[model samples]
Target: MKPSFLASLLLAAVLGAGGSILLTHASPAQAQTSTASTDTVTIFVDATFGFRKKHMATQLTKTHAEYAARGYRYVDMAPYNENGDLVGFFVTYSKQ
Candidate 1:
């Protein structure tokens, strides 16, 4: 009803609207990151006898080809170890 009270109410409404807008909108980078995360799949190869370079290389090559044919691209590869022993490998692929 009073002038000061009306001004305060308007300010509060503006601040609330701005906060809601900010919280509801996502940046481009964040949107892309979330999309990329969901579009990626990790392939794990089990090696009971430990990782041999030649065998692992051949297996990875075949895997790359298989995924590539399905419109996927290689993203990353890392060795998986357990108790100080080389166990297998984790290969990550993402949709192109």
Candidate 2:
């Protein structure tokens, strides 16, 4: 418990805490931006289970039409299979 060693430990602790605070918080001017993070989102549609309810074709067409009206593009789709039959859908859509 030397006095010099205690002072050094106190200094290190203060510096470490200050550094942590500076790194964790962003200043006000640096926080805002006019740009968006991205223009697309991936949606997983439970088309398989819903297929029995609305009967796939009718449901899909109506949903797609709604998205198109909103200026979204249906980029890609993946069908989930269960017992060798397609049951669910994963769709990627994008808009500016």
Candidate 3:
């Protein structure tokens, strides 16, 4: 094999490994938090009705405020489903 080709392959391999490591370490805690959020959303959806995206957004905002007042960090609010009469919502938060 040509030297330049070998160097390029080596660089690619190193970059790939570095990227994998960075991605792995960067979000382990976030991933756990995301799992927790999914659980929370499932619970919230199960306990509520008429959860449209717009309504969920407002509700999540209020929930975040309430949680924040109690010392929590809000990560995000995502709409899972939006079919007519069957809506789903997910709220994500991180501990402060």
Best-to-worst order by TM-score is 1, 2, 3
Return the TM-score for each candidate structure: 0.53, 0.49, 0.39
Ten-residue stretch with the least lDDT total in model 3: 39-48
Error of 1 at 79 (Å): 0.7
Q: In order, what is each prediction's RMSD in angstroms?
A: 16.3, 15.4, 13.0
Model 1: residue 71 alpha-carbon error in angstroms = 0.6
Model 1, span 1-96: residue lDDT tens:
899999999999999989844533322111123363468777676444232445766777888999899898899988876667655677888888
lDDT of 2 at 81: 67
Scored by Cα lDDT, where does model 3 land?
A: 0.51
Compose the digit string of candidate 3's lDDT tens values, residues 1-96: 999999999999999989855543342122232454343221132113332335655655676687678666766655543334324445565566
What is each predicted model's overall lDDT from 0 to 1? 0.67, 0.60, 0.51
Clashes of each: 0, 1, 0
- What does the lDDT come to for candidate 1? 0.67
